[model samples]
Target: MVHQLAGRLNSIDPQAGEALRIVSYFDVLIARGVGLDGLLRGAALLSGTVAGAEIRGRVTRRDPDGHAPADAADARRRSSPRSHDTWTVWLERDGEPGPDDDMIAERLALGVYLLEERRRPDSGIDAIIDPNRSAAERAVFLARHRTDPETRVRVLATPADAADTGAPSAIVPTRYGLLKATLDRSGRLAPPEPAGLGTWVRADRAPESWDAAIIALRLTAPDTPTVDATDLGAMLLLAQAHDPQAPHEDVRALAALDQRSSDVLRTLVEADSIRSAAGTLGMHHSTVQARHEALTATLGYDPRTTTGRMRYTAAALLLRLIDPITPARTPSA
Candidate 1:
């Protein structure tokens, strides 16, 4: 298996030789049923060829001062998420590890392979990251990192511009999939396609972080060329509220209006002023005013009012959930 992987890695680029060897060592330990914690320890030792080499995963919360929050793992078994997003890997030797452009590409590709394997046993990397090891092994692994400050959890998401790639195995046929990568606490990322970022956390919280990462990926715009979890913002909140099966009453009401009324109402809501809406819709000011009053009567609220505006906006958001591809404002009605 090592020889086969070496050949494939060499084909991708000769530089991958070192990484492939590391992965191969990991593979051996995995086949021996050495748990993830053991694999990480082994990786740290293997990377010792580099000066002061260390390998560890961290769930980092960055502060405005360009620092990470103090280690609070002793009092916590989970992440106290604040601006909570992205998981990162630290591969350091003599200097602070960082992901430059080239390193980002490498990590992104590796992450994609690892993520696929996690879902199903597609390659050797799968065995390395899986958490379901024997109780003894898991205990041993936990013992090794019990004092570590970083949370040992991960979040994975795909970037917008993923590419077609083959599976990690040399003989497996290639297929298209999102490229994924792990980010660091410093917010550095490799270019991602099936892009994702992971962090260290209490073992139990890993799945929650992973779910958030998936939500971030779903909110990512298709036209967005790159992926970053930090940008999810309120979109994540909306994602939490989004219910595809729920009846969207306001959205339905908006859709039920006539084309001119719908267009006029949307314009009024967007522009905030009747005159501006009239200019935008190319209708007389009085005509727009009349439509606005008519819409208010139909919807039982004046759209210009704050309460009405909130409903309109929420309905618009709901409409997006319903038919995201459709324009925010329908044509005619």
Candidate 2:
């Protein structure tokens, strides 16, 4: 009956018939639960061009042959209006668009939106990390995940989409902007560069772990990408003492130093001897000695001394906490 109706429509209006066919094709794909790849492939075949969708930070593209192209440039394309502020679907046609081009693009966008809704995580990571929620509510979520109040878990915080560990995760807002927090049970999670691993704590104390994780993330640097909370020990206390509005004199001084000078200062404070610091920095001992003298004169403290080293380390850590690099805004599901 559907085919006969389509035939009759084609006889009267070919464009209307093609529009109906495009709608029916996407409807069937949706009913069969075809994933993002299937949806893109169907759109590409129907439009006789390359189709693509970028959801969250991930991009997927498919050519008419159902294969991903190496370099699918964005030219002569018709894109659907941005949906949910996180995704967009488009078709890159070769010549003038066909009569049903707009319809195919619209249906592809709708298909992707439906698929994202269906695949959205139902996990309670957001509730578990949210401080606004009551303890009873958090406990209920923990129980649903088979985690008791006393079971220990560490939170790993990284930049958004930085890690793909299959652990339960969520994008959480912090003083440092949006960060992706993943709950790790085994304590062996190796997140990507510039990540932080919070100290192990009870499930009920997850909020504390999250706080510590953000602190650790701030402490990460070019030389050290991942920082463990336990290693920080008393330094964590110093982090709480910071006042961003009224910056410390030492932190301000350290921030003034150029990158090369900062590296030299960091090496001098961390290394046991001048020779060792020079070796680590791959600089001649004389050059390092000269830079050290220059830095000491500029900062009004001899960083090689025990007290100076202590002061320099504390100031450096604090400087990281106040880093001004703003993160991207939180993304919608």
- Strongest candidate by lDDT: 2
The parts of candidate 2 lying over 4 Å away from their true place are 1-121, 243-246, 270-294, 324-333
Candidate 1, lDDT over the whole model: 0.44
The CA lDDT at 122 in model 2 is 60
Candidate 1 local lDDT, 68-151, one digit each (tens): 336442232221111101232333323434223223223322332333344443332221233454434434433443422234
**Model 2 quality (TM-score):** 0.57
List lDDT for all candidates, in order: 0.44, 0.77
TM-score against truth, every candidate:
0.40, 0.57
Model 1, residue 213: displacement in angstroms?
4.5
